[model samples]
Target: MATAPVAEAVSLDHRLGDVVVRLEFADDGPVRLVGLVSADAFDASRPPRPRVTPLVELSFAGESHVRHSHGTRHRNYAATSRLRLVERVADARRLSVTQRDPETGLVVVTTIESTTPTTVAIASHVTNEGAGPVAVEYLSSLVLGGFAEAVEADVFRRLRVHTCLMAWTAEYRWRDESLADVGLVDAGIPHPTSSTRTSYSFGALGSWSTGTHFPQGAVQDRESRQLWMWQLEHNGPWNAELDDVGRDVALSLSGPTFRQHHWSQQLLPGESFSSVRAVVAPVVGDVDDGIAALTGHRRAARAAGAVELPVIANDYMNCLMGDPSTEALLPIIERAAAVGARIFVVDAGWYADDAGWWSTVGEWRESRARFPNGLVEVTRRIRDLGMIPGLWLEPEVMGVDSSALGDLPDEAFFRRAGRPVAEQGRYHLDFRHPAVRSRLDAVVDRLVAEHGIGYFKLDYNVNIGEGTDVDASSLGAGLIGHERAYLAWLEAVRERHPGLLLENCASGGMRADPAQLGVTDLQSTSDQEDPVLNAMIACAAPSVIVPEQAAVWSYPQPHYSDDLNDFTMIQSVLTRVHLGGRLDLLSPAQLARVKAALSVHASLESFIPAAVPFWPLGLPGWQDEWLALGLRSGQRSVVAVFRRGGTATVLLPLEGRATILHPIDRGARVSEEPNGLAVTVPATPGAVVLDLIG
Candidate 1:
């Protein structure tokens, strides 16, 4: 096909029902698009946010194509469409589309522009002419060749499906070849992570979904269901979906309460409709060939940009500890490295003798009995164990009796003439003060030079309050000064340890926003022990905009509600980003439980940034108190399932023909089928494994 010149006549409008798609671009530039919008209903009480697909690039045979039609699910409809219209009106030969609707009084106009070879933009606009206000829904979807599945596959989310209706929100069961007709169930229904993610929101809607996708022959007969983007609910790949949980969330759902993603809309009188234009780009294409086509951003950030350092995972028992001494966690640290713990950190209590004395901030020194060998011996031991040694510190804190605040010159602190420091009854540090900065710099330099510290779990116990102790009229930023001190510490630390990973903890989510996250590497997910609640933390994890890290509880805890079996299953399905748990504290059987959990953890831990790559709606009682469940990730696909304690029927989410490997009573069984995988497992409360086989 010959190309159109920059001065060529451009096609301007196209329509689809209530939507009028427009196209435009510059003669010497690439395509640009706009989506004039509307909503399904018009009421000021509930305003709707219209959706639009402003820029979509189509590709064919791994290259750009230029043709389009609504009904075909082949080639690339966004970039390679035969018509270079959406973003390339400059090259369009003839573009025309029309739509009629009572809600839209303006004639739907679409403009197509082709600014250069293989680049186009198509936009839709509806001018409100006759109606007072109209609400409209945005309709923009792309048909790109396999990048959707490719990125998913590259990320290892290939669940081969043979069903079309793809039960968007249905529950499924496992299969049993020995039992008549029972071979149709899959051990893991929907997807593994869906049970947790859907309840939380993390800003953008990216590579997330739920459903049954089975690798061919992986399972001969499991049904697949719940197929769509939103089904898997964590914010795309390599995201901190569970780590920075509490900080960045748009909505949340725990019980029967249904939080709408977004519904209804309001169109201002004579203002037409509010619209949002979306650019649909393939997440995976040849990175070399598709970066420009997809992200519009060139090369990726330097692969080695982040400073590499191991981080410690505690204040010992975490927030609950009034005294870290009682926890006996130091011994666990040595034992951890013995079993492969790479980063060793001495938690909170290591500072003040008790929590009440935590404000002794500026005077950080090793407590006596906690480490009789002194901090040096501990670091030596960590080195002997072949792991990097790290520690925890809340340099931003100050106690009334501490030397940094109580004894320091009043000129060195943040103080006001008469107002009480709102939150912290004690005084605060003046971060901007040159002396304060020098103090922190000395600490970091001392730690690095003396103990070979690998990482720092920088902690902030409380938000310092502005108090009369600070001469506010003359002492700038009484309370905020403390915050500024933290920033200075962060900048100094990075400047010192550019390759060190910084873990941020400000009473959990207090400072877990973008500004702080950009300076830190990892953040804890939550304080909750129950996987369900922790999952809520994981749901909000990725919104932090940093490296993904969700603190997973591994030890089979002696809790009130769960027995060994139930807890084991839940632990496996819990967040992937984790720090090893307290195996030394559990019972003997729970010790064995640690090994069991370790096997699963070992396989998935390194890939946590991938997060829950695949997840579909789970068993109906999953959110309820059902005790039996299982998940299987093998060769190319994964099969998971859930069943009630007394309910006899178990539904599987495997689709089409498959061959499976399962754990039966006497031993293991492997079988093949035309549609899906086949399996037979002993009706017990444990995982049944199956490799995706031919």
Candidate 2:
């Protein structure tokens, strides 16, 4: 007996704490994202407003129609084609939607999991089901759009887009633009026109995942005070776009693609591939509210058995600059521990025996010339000082003159056209090869066992564009495979050395993507050495990374004045202070100030993990004279304000009753106002940390 499919419109709604997601289905037809609203804004009594946006969009080879063109003719079948729903399932924490395209033999299973009250993590898995290989051009992890209310005249005026631009020295530089200014909306009130269609897209090029821009953004509706924030959690080529689909705006988050980065994946029968996870959250307040929700989500997503966020002193930045030696680091180590650094890391040059050691790096052993008594003496000194021993290692690359370059198998290195892809006197390793993993494992194990090393600062310096075509269908696929293998190796390392702590750095803050961040313990915020310039990165980093995991360098030298020393120390106290610089060269008074700041950091360390960040002075401008950031936990809050070149008195919005408002240094004066705090600063640069007991 032939049975006809049910023709009724079916929908399912799931609530995760304060957020609601509703999915709609038409019999066995296409699936759509009908609703994604906060619990406070959603009205059950009103008729359902089903969004006309596809849940997932995919482009495959041999397809003719362009579903949603962004100034290009690309075959995007899943964009417009009817994706028949195979199954839908939901639980208290997650909702899964399974859909299949009959023409391409592609099955996409989208899962949305709630990590916090207001944040949902989304990921899509694509599998090839037919006999022949399917060439995938585009696969978006998240495709959300169709906000009709935003198209109204008044509402459209209040719409703004927020994205953070990043670089080597200046990271987390935020830029806010109106929807009309960004061409996402028309000039006049709501109207239909052929010229209204536009797309604003941005992404990174290679391994320096966040070199150009961060893979995170937010859209805010000022009238409703609602913000939608999202981040693509990948460490490689990634793209995010804001598209005008005629009636409404759309957002697509995906990795590399054929049209954009010459990336394509050929999936054979029964083969499957998964897109990088995209986390999206909706908050009912301002950007702070969105950041709070995302912070909670990040806390929930962190790996279990993570190390405590402690004060770490790395001998880099204003200090050694990859020239560490026994004589140079011993005094620094002694002073670092005296200032209460829980971890003392010997950053770079520990394995170098010559000036030309940069191109001869793959050997992880101690340098006989640099450390006469071997590295064990230094590690022992660090441990005896009541601190964990740490070292800097660039694990994924072999220097061009490295002996391992010839020792390791050719398949272990990334090769393009039978030649190793060399960049900046280094050859990238293809982690997909077992030889590469074995070599890294041996080096890590030897270091830990030989030196009793408890911490590792993993750094990646150069970008090997696209990737090498080895053991994969395309260059992008090869890169994806290597990334997955690297993640697996990291997991294995963590499993083996459960007590080891790893810090992620990329020339620094370049590879601070959620994909790599999910596995590592801390992130180096930036390599910017100047305290005044680093203030901008420190103030804005919490929006992209958890404050507890953001490692900001506080490097004070002898030449710095008392106010300058206080400014640098306060920059790191509010976050994971990666204390650096010539501690051995600092004067007694300057060292006292550094130790006092560490005391304050220790007092507040217990509350950092539970704290949610808020920008009292809004997102800091690149050239802003005054900047402020607050962290609220329970009824208490900690606010850090910096005065670079501002007026004498600057008013800061009060988060609560100022119970303990005091300057960490000597020149700054503080007073309470009716609705805010009036801070008076000297002409010289200074900073202060305020502890508000609500």
Can you give the TM-score per candidate against the true fold?
Answer: 0.48, 0.95
All models, RMSD in angstroms: 16.7, 2.8
Best by TM-score: 2
lDDT of 1 by residue, 268-332 (tens): 34543211211221112121111122111100111233232232334343222434442365566
User: What are the lDDT figures for the candidates, one per model?
Assistant: 0.36, 0.81
Note the clash tally of each candidate.
120, 0
- By summed lDDT, the worst window of 10 consecutive residues in model 2 runs over 187-196
- lDDT tens digits, residue span 231-344, model 2: 888888888887655446667888888767668889899999898899888778888888788887887888453336688999888988889898888999999888888999
Off by over 4 Å in 1: 1-315, 318-322, 325-327, 406-430, 463-491, 535-547, 558-581, 586-589, 610-614, 618-694
Native-referenced Cα lDDT, model 2: 0.81
